[model samples]
Target chain A: MPILWLFLIVLAIAAAGYVIGRSRAVASVGGDHRKMHSLASFYGSNVAIKVFVPAFLFTIAWLLVQPIVVNATVSDMIPEAAIADNSSRGLVMAEVRRIADGLDSAVAAGGMSADFARTPQTDLDDVTQRIKDAGGVVTSDITAPVLNAAQRYRAMNGTGNFIMSGLAILIALGGAWWGIRESHADFRARNTVETSIRALLIGAASIAILTTLGIVLSLIFNTIEFFRLYPAADFFFGTNWAPSFSGRGGSSDLGVLPLLWGTFYISIVALAVAVPIGLFAAIYLSEYASKRVRSVAKPLLEVLAGIPTIVYGLFALLTVGPLLLEIFGKDGLGWMQAGTAVMTAGLVMGIMLIPFVSSLSDDIINAVPQALRDGSYGLGATQSETIKQVVLPAALPGIVGAILLAASRAIGETMIVVLGAGAAARLSLNPFEAMTTVTAKIVSQLTGDADFASPEALVAFALGMTLFVITLALNVLALYIVRKYREQYE
Target chain B: MMKDNADERIGVDAMDIKFAAKDVQVYYADNHAIKDVSVDILDKTVTAFIGPSGCGKSTFLRSLNRMNDTIPICRVEGDIRLDGQDINAPEVDPVQLRAKVGMVFQKPNPFPKSIYDNVAYGPRIHGLARGKAELDEIVEKSLRRAAIWDEVKDRLDAAGTGLSGGQQQRLCIARAVATEPEVLLMDEPCSALDPIATAQVEELIDELRQSYSVIIVTHSMQQAARVSQKTAFFHLGNLVEYGDTTDIFTNPRDTRTESYITGRIG
Candidate 1:
């Protein structure tokens, strides 16, 4: 196999390079005690690399081009009567291979058939991989001319393979010899390798920028496709959101108002749940907790954050949804539909965000200069007064940025909403009522059977663009607030 | 330098045991910061503490009103008494102590508010003024006392952070003064100011002696000589010398005090 030949050639190259390098190292001493350039091994490796790299590349390129070229040429030689307009070249190639196998099988059995179509198989040194239809000749009564052509063709094929592979190995050995000769003490191989590595790093750095550009452009083009089927005005302003591409005729209207409402409602609920709890917890951890308490509590809360969103989604669906339905189901206080309402998802999401808000705020609070706190305390202010008047105000900007980031995450969240916030898309005032958001609708419209070109499917892109713009705007605002905040202390 | 005790005591007011700290030792997380510091702060005169850094000048300054109690790991042992009542007594509150003895910090720490609110913060918290007009009077009086009333009277609503560095420090001084404390503690208040601001603040401190007992911790010996009536020399947490400012600066009896004042050593 090609793998085995490459391995053997590499070993021989290493040995030759080593011997040549060792000789060069010893000879350059010139009867004096001091040595000349590089070690023998370095010379040998240098020559080996010189010989192997180019020849290996050439052999690989030839191997690829030769097979395709031979296949195409032989494909033309296939029976023209058997081919048709609808027939494929792949099938034709398969037939040629089968025919060659049959010829080989017949020749090995010493029984050449009588249906031989090949008469001058070897005389014309065709470079095609095809063999003269060997199965067509009869064993004892095969035509003389046909037998000679078959043998000659086989000989030519064998000779071509030997030369191609032999040259590949020879070039590899020559490269090893040259690598050894060129090896010297001053070669700076490290710098050469590092320069190439630096180029690779630059290549990697541009990928992040390009990927962002790619996502934006892809969204814009796809959104344009969606607008072709649905009017932009209706998509933006419509109140209902029921997308039925199957044309069943009873489906409700599809608009963004319901999803927007749901996103706002859930986010409000999540903020309601997250802000007080996160802030209070952060205060306790950063200000009140002893070192021992902090050591234990910090990592435990981080573990809560590490639980995957999918697991939270499953918990909402399997546990909370049914439990709430039982408590509120048209019987007991029927004000609630199920536990997996806006409150449920928001509360769970808030719990997940506790560590994020706390850790970020904690760092910002700690970073607030120690002098400010001392100044407040020196003024005879109590611990509570100092924190309320001095530290929190100083840390407010970073906290606002953190809250904005959390809000974006809330808006973009999908799994928990999909499982808990039911498929209903309505402008309802009740938090207990089922609702859907932009991300949930995106998952729904994209997954079900719908044409990619359809307005319904393309609606996801428009939603995506909206989400992107909102998050970007929020990011700018948060950064502005944080920067202004720092300017006060700096 | 050539002053007797009676001449030195010319400006000194009769003391009624206003505030006294006895053998107070402070530790921060088991690291001994101040060891066995004892001092008395009189009613209506400027008392200056001069020392090399880490000699616990500021640490002793914080102990007069129990400000070190705010720091969780900063432990204090020994009694600090105010008006014959122990401040470390179980029922006595640190907040009340701070309200009665306000402080100016080393750096200008004006709150991120309008110049008016920065001055009015302490009064607003303590509910000192009943209405807007009364609060205005308090603000004007505090700013005037700090010698920044004319510079900022026109733009009271401008952000405190918008002021120049010296002005910001004066604003912080006005903030502490607004609380109407009987004793004012200034911890290296001029360390972050220019020489002009330092001179202005020293003039203000001289004027302040008429109303409040001012204990100042300063690095500048010239400042201590100019603004203080009484001087306490601290060396390695010990109150090594205490007497009239002129006497201590000119003819210190202690060898350590002589070496420090003469610039032979710190």
Candidate 2:
């Protein structure tokens, strides 16, 4: 049976349980709802939950476990003599699984018989041709041992699925039976349902947290593997970043310093452009703008944030880069060699981050207690003087946190740098010179005909780990500052 | 001796009027907050505006320094003169006027700066001090005058917000006085303080009467009697009575004032 159909069957069982449980509860109270321990709907929900949750959980567990067990049993059936040199057991297992799927599909399409698919006497070429004709993928001609393994794999999977379907329905029926039996007036259905809901919510929240943990762990393992191939000291401190992609054995300099420098320099430039403009914009919006102007202008300013960074990358590549090139390119001031440089990327990234800094700082400024402003104005200070001396100082910690968050954003930015800043990692001071960031290089290292085992390719994970650490530290610091500010005010 | 002197000074025409309002009407977004109120505020005296909550005493006091100008919906009509010059005139800047008429709010709001910096803020913005030495001298003098110098002199670098409720209010008073304003408007400055702090602030207010014309808005009728030489009772946005403190308490001319003072009606 299809999993969707199984799911619907379970749902139908739960629906029946709901109706039976509600009516039973009501009958136990002699049809008087006032005498029931909980509402009729609560009893219904309790039965539905009992019928659905455990059964669905069992179904999912079965679905996950069945393939692993089938693969292990079927791969053991293939003799070691049939395995070729320079290929892994895991690879053979992948082929076996694919061939098994193909045979199943071929049988389903009426090009082959179920008896022939399960039997060992079928011709290998004819079976492979029929599988291919049935629109199933086959990497190579099937050997006798492999064909026998594929047949066993299909047999085991079919039996496993059949058992899973039977077990799931049995569990659903058992749960529904137990729930209906417990549907008396004294049963605390509401509390039981409430506890289940709380557990469900906790399960949801933990899944999100666990997924993040899993991603971090994966990155950590890969980074460790990369460091095993490449020297840690060289990766961390070496100034050069030239990765020779000729082959794995070739000497490659995977220094992170130049890339780190580029990241920082571009981030500094971005911050330099963003901080003043963004802060000023925030001040104008929060302090000076009238309600009419603010209602329109605040959202319009935030609209800049809503524009995807990829679109900004395009704008940087097509418009801002060329515009800057016209002023500082070789034909003009001779300061820039091409349109794509650190300054081009930095400028566009700054524009992209303006809304980030402005919106956050605006909220921070607005959060500064009106009492402080009142105290300043009461002292005969001008509006500008009041904001400068009182409001800004009170809002300073929060604004710094906002700026740091924007800084992290600038450092993590990839698309803008890839399109605007050229893909050369150079340790130069000139803003107009081409340089690349860690994220940009991470992109470049992974997306070509590079060997996965090679340091050049695995270095993407290392770069990712490094970038993650830096941004994570920045986020922690930002949160710390913001929290400290909140404590001070409240 | 101070009480005898205050009584002797009352009703004396020799005293100069610091602020004179003529038929001042204040409307906040079509809500008539202050209605046709007029009173003469004398120099070198503490005058109290006493009323129930939402009775417009604070509104009338805020109108004195034009603090109401900060509220976009607030509109002030008629003439209010500071030292015989119309403060509401187009030529008069509210900023400069605020320097001459400093205010302490109902709550103790100290700037999020060091104690030294908080006192120096007003003088620095107004350019009252020519140098750091002069600025320091002014801060010390103002703090000393506000009676907070001794408590905070050792830790002037400490954040002003770190002070206790009463100390912060006194620090605010010092900050206001640092500008050397001719008039000081205190809107229930000791309301947030305990009895001890209130007494301390009341004593400071009485002392402040020596240098500045002080107008205070208070909820407590006893606080008005304790602090002010002159008392104005406002009822329902109307100035029901204005007289010497002793007469306002002991012998009120209006039935409403009598009822309010005797706790019959608010």
Candidate 3:
């Protein structure tokens, strides 16, 4: 049976358990529910939890562990002579699994009897032809040892699935019987059900945390592998970033300094454009704008944040790049060489980040207590002087946190740099010069046709690890500052 | 000895009027908060406005310094003069008027700065000190006048907000006094202080009466009687009676004032 059908069977058993458990609890106290330890729904939920949880857990575990066990046993059955010199054991296992599936389909289509297909003396050509006629793909002519391994793979999988279905249903039935037996007036069904629900929620939360850990572990291992192939010191300190793609073990100078410099320079330019404009906009929105104007304008300003970064990337490429090129190109200032330069991406990314800084800074500024402003005004200070000396000082730490978050966002931006900042890794102070960031280069390295095990391709993981560590540190610092600021007033 | 001296000064300085108001009315968005009220505030004395909550005593006091102008919907009408100059005139800026007439709020609100900086804020903004030494002298004088010098003199560089509630209020008083204002308006200044702090602040107020005219609004009738020389009783936005503190407590002229003092119809 299919896994979906088995899942529905377990649910049906649990549903029956719910009805029986509720009725049994009531009947135990002569149909007076007031004598029960818990409510009627609680009793029903307890029974359903018992019947569904364990059976579902078992089914999942069987599905995860069966393939490995079966593959290990069946591959051992194949002789060493069947193994080819060029292909790996994993590749042969994949072919074996595919041929087994094909044979299963051929038998299910009535092209051959099961016993006849399993006979060792049956013609391989005949079985292959029958598999092809049954609409199964055959990559090569069937060999004797591969044919025997495929048959064993099919037989083991069939037995494993059958056993899994039977055991899951048996567990469900046993849980239902035990639940109904315990469904008396004195049973603490409510507490048990509540505990189960709490466990379920904890399980959900841990899944997210565990997934993040898994991603970090994968990045760490790949980074270690890359370091083993390429010297760590050279990768970190070297200035040149030229990757030769002729083949593996070629002369490739993979340095990270130029990329780091480009990332920092572009981020500086972006923050220069974003911080002042965004901070002033936040001040106006929070402090000066009237109620009616604020209600209309705040959301309209936030609409800038909702625009996709990809759309901003296109704008940087098509519009801002050309505009800056005209002003600073040979005709205007003779500083820029082309449309794609650090200035173009930085300016456009700053526009993209305006709403980010404004929205967060606005909230932080608004969090400042009104009594401070009142105290300042009571001392005969003007409104502007009060804001400059008193209000802004109180909100400075939180605003710094917001700016750091925006800085991280600018550093990790990929599409904007790819489209606007040309794919040339260089270290220069001129904003008009084209430069590439770490994220943009990561995309280029992985999408190329290099071998997966080569250092040039594995270098993407190292770049990813570096970028992740930097952003993570920035986020932690930002959160720390924001939390410390919150403790001041409350 | 101080009470007799103050009484003798009141008799000798009967013509020293510091503030005069005529038929003043206040409105907050069409809600009449203060009715027609007129009073003369004499210099070198403490006058107390005593009333129940929401009786417009604080509202009327705020109008004296044009602090009510900060609220968008608050409006004040009629003429109010400080030192014989019409403060409502367009030629007189509210900022200058406020510097001339300072205020202390009910709660202790101090700036998040050093204690010395808190005391020097007013003098610094008004350009009363030409040098750092002069600014330091002004800070010491103000803190001493507020009667909190010894407790905080050693920690002048400490954060003003780190002080106790009473100390913070005294720091605010010092801040206000550093400007050398001719009048001080206090709105329920002792409401948030304990009995010990209240007595201390009352003593400071009595000493302050020797130099500047002080007006205080209080909810406590006994507090008003203790700290003030003149007492005004307001009920439902109306000033029912005004007289010497002894007479107002013993021989009130209005039945409303009598009922309020006797705790009958507040």
Query: Best-fitting candidate, measured by TM-score?
Result: 2
What is the Cα-based TM-score of model 3? 0.91
Better of 1 and 2 by TM-score: 2
TM-score of chain B of each: 0.95, 0.97, 0.97
- Flag clash pairs in model 2: none
Docking class of 1: acceptable
> What value does DockQ give for candidate 2?
0.76
- Show where candidate 1 strays beyond 4 Å: A1-202, A248-253, A326-328, A448-450, B1-16
True contacts kept of 2: 0.78
lDDT tens string, model 3, A1-490? 8899999999999999999999999999999989999998788888888999999999999999999899999889888878788877777788888889888888899988898667674588988899899888888788888888998898899899999999999999999998988899999999999899899999999999999999999999999999999999988998988888786745888899999989988888899999998999999998888879989999999999998888989999999999998999999999999999999999999998999899999998898887777677777877777788778878888999999999999999999999989999988899999999999999999995868799999998999999999999999999999887676654
- lDDT at residue A290 of model 3 (Cα atoms): 81
TM-score (0 to 1) for chain A, all models? 0.65, 0.93, 0.94
Give lDDT: candidate 1, residue A201. Answer: 85
> Which ten-residue region of model 2 chain A has the weakest summed lDDT?
A481-490
RMSD list, candidates in order: 8.3, 2.7, 3.2
Residue A100 displacement in candidate 1 (angstroms) = 16
Question: If scored against the real structure, what TM-score would every candidate get?
Answer: 0.77, 0.93, 0.91
Which number leads on DockQ? 2
Per-residue accuracy of model 1 over A1-490 as CA lDDT, tens digit each:
2546765776677667666755664565652323544444544545555665567676778677765655655555555654457766665455445444445665555544324323344332221222333333232222333234334344434444566677777777776656555555445433433554586688788998899989999999999987777877777899989877776323535578899999889888878888778887888888889989988987887787789888888888888767776777567668686666876676667777777788778878878888777767656676788789888988899999889877888888888888878878889998888888898998998996867876777889999988888888888998888887786777
Work out the iRMS of candidate 2: 0.7
Q: Chain B TM-score of model 1, please?
A: 0.95
